[model samples]
Target: MLTTVRLSIIVMVLSISGDLFSQIRNNYFSASHPYFNYMGRVDSSQREYVRFDWPGVRVRFRFTGKELKLYFKGGQRNYFDLIVDEKRMGVFYASGDTVVEIEGIKGKGPHSVQFIKRTEGEMGEARFYGAAFYPEGKLLPWIGNSTRRIEFIGNSITCGYGSEALGRDEKFDPRTENVLKSYASIVANAFQADYHVVAHSGLGVVRNYGDNQPVSVNLATMPQRYSRILDMDDSSTWDFSSWCPGAVVINLGTNDFSTKPHPDKAIFQRKYEELILKVRNVYGSVPVFCLVGPMIDEPCFSYVKEMVENFKLVYNDSNVYFIGIPTELLNDKDDLGADWHPSYIGHQKIANFILPVMSNILKWNY
Candidate 1:
């Protein structure tokens, strides 16, 4: 009888241990898992952690579970948008290393999650460690990336600075800056394209916003930063071949022409042309759209249009085109966000204006 009792106890313990092991194995997934689909310029060198700093960077995956938790290590305060099963739950902020838990998920079967960065690179970088699911879950194959891709290069406007501010008089706050609400994002979502934003607030093609000296070479200009994977890290070069865009949009000149001592037209045009050439060198005849303002006008507008026309004539390139967003497109009273930047409504208008043009140019069905 003593021997039989001992045998039964051992069997119970073994069964419990086996169940625990299986639960752990099925519930946890590393960030490097093949099923996690990462978009934008992400550094995946580390097996356990994937890092990205660009605005609009996104990670998507699917799993089967009732509850999900995501782990992240942020170098600085950054905001993100969390979407589960195509519905946006809300915006959340992460700083330092932390775990975000979403409890009481609606369905019991399979569900999808999209985690997107809503701020720009200046907000700092973040590392995604992995995810954990409760009550028996397993990672599913990723939904997959869109075949359509676009790259937008610009300054504050493209970065969606002050996009979510309460009003034009409101001060610039990081919390209010939502790139997901920007025109670039709106346009991308409209066409169902995976897009990249190589944008920095206050940056320009030749001179940055409010710089006193004109024609001074800004080492951190958009052209120089274009090749970097991380906006702040100049040493880290992005592999252009890894992801190429079907269309490229350059929405600069707002910062270059915003302040006094404007850059010489010749110099400005030269730099703009160089930037265009750089795009050509990288992608080989991808449709390039030279965009000018909803904020800037006059010389900046004329300069861009002239430069694009000249570039086409000189290079014999028909793929390059010019599009302008006039100041009249937005209403000053109702359409401004923080610090007089375009609000979500303003961005929507901008997207609507450009959508048809883009569709006509790229032959993409709306």
Candidate 2:
């Protein structure tokens, strides 16, 4: 009787294990799968993959499982911040193989996660292959984005460089930055609009921050890499044809003028206006708002406004507009992030100022 009981127990255990294995799906999805959310220009990778370099570019997926994992391969060393549900998780460096699975969410759950790249474009880009889920895992469909799309183009400020750090003097680390916490993301989210961020650190419209290397020897600036998917190289071009934003916000020239005795005012104004025209030609009739920063003050600020006025009048373009963040907010040390960048509250302050401006301009309900 004891032997028979033991054999019966073994059979029950085997049955349960079989059921669990049956529910497990080790399937790898195509990189182009709609379940992923991308925030920048992306290009098709070999076979079934997608790659991007714009800081803060990432993917989101939903699954019904107790455990979830991601598969990715990155060049050089790359990092990403994981947000499970809405809670910010730790940052993880990408490994060549599958990452350890995230399990036991509040013990067990059907969880949603957003994987955001925390590094700048100059550092490296991440290529995501797919995700994994266990025990009845299923991928939810892509979150449909019905609102008018908007694109923010600029430098580190737009990239959220050091936006999460505590001190103004704290050296900026890629891990401390979150592009989603930047003013661009804040404004986009406030208006329920999908956004594309094309930004890098220390890059400018016509010059680089503290680097005086001639164009022949220096890295590409914003205008040069404007249409490229990867910021480092021209390996692939962004198919602007695939998606169109109703408006484009440009916040540049900070790096160009970062050094004392800035670039020639006449030349800077000309190049700035030319950049505006280029954006107009690409997006076609989309309102182009020339944005300035809280980092800028006084005479420099006055110069930017003058350039905007000239661009609008010169091109006879009524759609081109100018908006500047309040300089007073820049003095608020508590709202400052690392290396003199804006913190989360600082970003919110800018977003708050522009939320109404965008709403009225875009005809958004918010």
Candidate 3:
């Protein structure tokens, strides 16, 4: 009788384990988080560029020895401070990965966590993972979801630029860096879609003071180093197999008009046309919107206007559009947040204007 009772207990335990495994559909150890087993066992592994950007909350969950270290990326201002699972923790940026260890969490059970961040601005980009796993365990099955992905390609303005709104000294002061509250974050929140931002400060399609590279007197205005996405190589970086963006919003031309002399007007026009063609080549029928700069000047502005006319004449299709942002939109002193980036309010205005246009493209159910 005793032997039979022990065997029954073992069988019941195995049955429960099987049920738990089936409940989880997809799980993976985010390269942004410390390595751990599904059973909640921590393993030391070098986490890669995993990142999360939300407002007022930034967290990094990693394993260092038996302890779980929680690294907090700083916030805009100490409006409220960060609260995780109802506990307060200090925040700091991890130029590299900051080591951390978690305690008390164990097993394959579900972990529910809530993050509360204060107002001055929040570094909400906190990401974590459980183990080195992927959906379907290395088998990427085709998901036939007719979903539209949108990719925004541009410069620091695209990157949130003046979102920090701090002075030059305060810009990188380590006190005001919050990636979570950028314009991309704001737009993504509004769109409720997967968004990718490929941007850098002071980078232009043609050569810029930052890059310090001279182009042939001949080649068109340097396309915003499209090849930069592919390690400065032209070997198929823009392929959109898994992430075919349905529409691409191009917000460049800002840095191009900097101190650098605008490329010969003709070259500029051709380069813009060619860039659009290349983008369409990879994305196929994806819609592309060319946004004129909020600060485009006389000659450059006229040139862009001409280019828009030429592109429309050539393509003669609605798939490509030049969204003219009037200077009136730029009249607000608040538009220039910092380092020539749009302020939070400025970004909102842009979003408000673009939202209707984008919703038209996305056919959002209003």
Candidate 4:
């Protein structure tokens, strides 16, 4: 009798375990699921997973669940912000192949979840293998993309480098680089638009920040990098036909002028024009706003203004316009982030400065 009782208990336990395992399997959803909505430049070539490195890339989904788990594989350590039902829950880090869990859900009904990449592409590429939910849960249709689209091609400013840092003196750490807080993201959000950020810290149109090289030998400049889907991989050419923006914002020249021995002024102008031409080549007369900064003034400001004017005349494209953000835009004492980069507050100010120009040009309200 004792042996029989033990056998019955063993079988019951195994049966329950099998059911749980089967339930988990049933609840798993692939990253390529049609219900998943992705924003920014993402490579979804793989059926099982989606890869992205650009900061501000977002994946959103709605599902009926009380708990959620995300399966992600990171090329290196990367951080992402979790938003549940339009509220930020927290930041989560992923490395290697890992499962991130969000439990203690308050409701039994369907909930929305969004993951926004906080770090720039140079930090690492990440692959999201999709999400798993509670046994009874399943994915629902995601909110569709916005009709308005904007593309920002810039440097560290667009990347939101150090936006979350405690102070201006603080050094840059990938954990504090929240691209969602950058001016590019803020402007896009304000306009209720989808945005793609093609930016890298210290990169420029010709000479990178603190680099003395001439234009001929300069490597990995914005023009070259802008066409890439992945920041770190040069071979991953982005297909422009897949996505096009209603407007393009270019904020370069800060890094080029950050130090002495800047690239030749003529070369800088030529390269800058070339970039605008490249944008026109693919996008076809989209409004291109060439921005000068709150960072460095004078030469960069003047250079960009002249370049845009010449570009309009030469290309006979009146859609290209120049907008300058004065140096006084940021309060040096309170608005500087890590290593004197723009803090979240600073980025907000920048966005405000550009918003009106964009609104008037694009005829977009709000």
Model 4 lDDT on a 0 to 1 scale: 0.84
lDDT of 3 by residue, 1-366 (tens): 011112111110011222332343443334333222111011123353322332232222222121122333222232222322334433333322222223433332222222222221122223332222211232122222235456676655565655557443225222433334555556655766545554445555554433333332332232544533221223323434545666788766665666655556676677777888878777786778777666555555676678767877878855776666665675446565665556666667777777777778768532
TM-score, model 1 to reference: 0.91
What is the lDDT, from 0 to 100, of the residue 19 in candidate 3?
39
lDDT of 3 at 30: 44
lDDT accuracy of residue 80 in candidate 1: 85
Q: What is the lDDT of residue 119 in candidate 1?
A: 87
C-alpha local distance difference test of each model: 0.84, 0.73, 0.46, 0.84
Per-residue lDDT over 1-366 for candidate 1, one digit per residue giving the tens place of the 0 to 100 score: 011112111100011221332344557898999999888888888986899988888889999888887777655758988888887776666566566667677667589889998888889998887888877877887765889999999777788889988789998788998888899999999999999998989888888877888864655788889999899888899989989999999999988888888999999999999999999998999999999989999899999999999998999999999898999999997789988889999999999999999999999986
- For each candidate in turn, the TM-score is 0.91, 0.85, 0.61, 0.91
- In model 2, the clashing pairs are none
Q: Which ten residues in a row have the lowest lDDT in candidate 3?
A: 7-16
Alpha carbon deviation, residue 359, candidate 1 (Å)? 0.8
Of the candidates numbered 2 and 3, which has the greater lDDT value? 2
**TM-score of model number 2:** 0.85
Off by over 4 Å in 3: 1-92, 100-146, 167-179, 209-224, 227-239, 330-333
